[model samples]
Target: MIYLDNAATTWPKPNQVTEAVAKSMKYYGANPGRSGHKMAIRTSEKVYECRELVADFFGLSNPANVVFTQNSTMALNFAIHGILKAGDHAICTVMDHNSVLRPLFAKSPDVDVSYLGADSEGVIDPSELEALIRPNTRLVAMTHVSNVCGTVTPVEDIAKVCRQHGILFLLDASQSAGIIDIDMQQMKIDLLAAPGHKALYGPMGTGLLCINTDFELAPIMQGGTGSYSKELTQPLELPDRLESGTLNLPGICGLAEGIRYINRIGIANIREHEAKLTAYLLDGLSRIKDINIIGKKNTLGRTGVVSFTHNSKDCVDISSYLSSNFSIATRSMYHCAYKAHEALGTSDGGTVRVSLGVFNTLSEIKILLYALKNMM
Candidate 1:
């Protein structure tokens, strides 16, 4: 099967990542940081190593500031709900996924939300953000890349605007992390969230949240943190303040291996490769008559995610046809971002999203192009 729904989750994780998860489950499956036994200590060390690797990969200085979660949605919830309080205003874009939009919606009326508009290409203007800043604007949450349109937002410029106003900057790197170059420290991002199952090539049920030391967010969950066990109140530490309950050790083990593999292969190579593939797909799709792409025609500042729709075909039906008849997997729908579809003028029926991954080859894309042509 040719899988092109990587925006949902990467297909066929690396062998090393699978091996690590299996090894952790079979060999060192003890609970990490919960006991004094050798097995527990070993598990603790492995988890710590993963934390350090993630911190370094993201240009964060302190590994303790990173907290593990189930997915980017959880991390985003913790960042959005935990940080904003009554009367606190926040800014987001229409291109934001439901993960960000829904959380912000839940806090509406109490926490004022200002949504910045994007053009037909789903690109947010950084200059417009400066005008939206208000005295009560405590945070500016932005997505590094739009999961719906594959448009890369100018996060660095947006972060600069947030820093100029002394407001915290939260980045939802759900679709950009590992595939895009993101420097947490240099970008002055106060809060960052990402899913390990996407470009990171990790197993599902793995996610991360990193907070800068100077910024403090209220604990979303409070319980045992394997530290300061005597006190009922949550520990006043970096990650312990955010992390609660038992960690996903097997998933994290795979995450660690995924990061290691990315490091070995080099992020620059991965980014360039994906960009090339996206450009190829864009070119091929544009040649087909009656097909309309939702975002930029070129892959100047985008990931491998390409969303398009045939004028006569329903996107859902087309996706089903690809899967059932051709064994080619593609995801179709609003992609949990109805706002994005509305902005792109495809709210009636969402576009077919063909998101590529590291394992995909040009040959697969060629097959997809021919299939799309025949369908047209």
Candidate 2:
């Protein structure tokens, strides 16, 4: 099968990641940080090692600032719900996913929100953000890349604006984490969230939130952190303050191996491979009659995701045809970003999305292009 839905969740995770999960489940099954037993201590050490690896990967100096979650959605929830309080103001963009939008919606009348608009190509101007900032604007949360069209945001420029205004910047790195080299320190990002299952190639149910040491957010969930057990309230430390209940040990172990795999292969090589495939796919799609390619037509300032719609054929029908007839896996519909679809003028039936991964090859692209051409 030719899989092209890496933007949702990666497939065929590295052998190292799978083996690490199995090893954690088979040997180190004890609850991390729950007790003083040797097994528990060992599990805790493994978890901390993964923390250190993630911290180093993202250029964070303190390992303790890394907090694990079930997925990027959860991490985003913790950041959004925790940071925005009553009477506070926050800013986001139309390119953001529902993970960023829904939480801000939940805040409702208690907190004020300003949405930045994106051009038809899903590109935003950093200069537009300065005018949106209010004295009460506390945070600006946005995605590093558009999940719908793989449009890369100008994060460094946006971060600079946020820093100059003394507003916090929260980045949702769900699509760009492992593929793009993101230096949280150099970028001056106040908070960063990413899923381990997407570009990181880790098992599902694994994500992380990296926080700058100076910023403090309120805890959304309060429970036992295995630290400060005597105190009735949650611990005020870095991770334990945010992390409640037993952590996902096996998932964290696998995530650590995934990060190691990325380090071994080098992210630049992965980016180059995906870019080649994306450009090829875009060229092929553009050649097909009555097809409209969404977002930028080229590889400039974008990741490997490509979305398009045919004039007559329904996007779901095209995706179903590829899956049933050609065994090609692709995504259709809003991609959970309705605002993006509306902004791009494809809200009627959404678009067919072909997102490439590291394991995909030029031959697979050829087959996909042939299938699409024949379908047309």
Candidate 2 has a TM-score of: 0.99
| lDDT to native, each model | 0.91, 0.94
Model 1 misplaced stretches (Cα beyond 4 Å): none
* Superposed Cα deviation of residue 239, candidate 1 (Å): 1.2
lDDT, candidate 2, 1-376, per-residue tens: 9999999999879999999999999877999989999999999999999999999999999999999999999999999988888999999999999999999989979989899999999998888998999999999999999999999999999999999889999999999999999999999999999998999999999999999748778999999888877889889898998999899999999999999999999999999999999999999999998889999999999999999999999999999999999999999999999999988889999999999888899999999989989995
List model 1 lDDT by residue over 23-113, tens digit each: 9998778989899999999999999999999999999999998899999999999999888999999999999999999999999889999
| Residue pairs in collision within model 2 | none
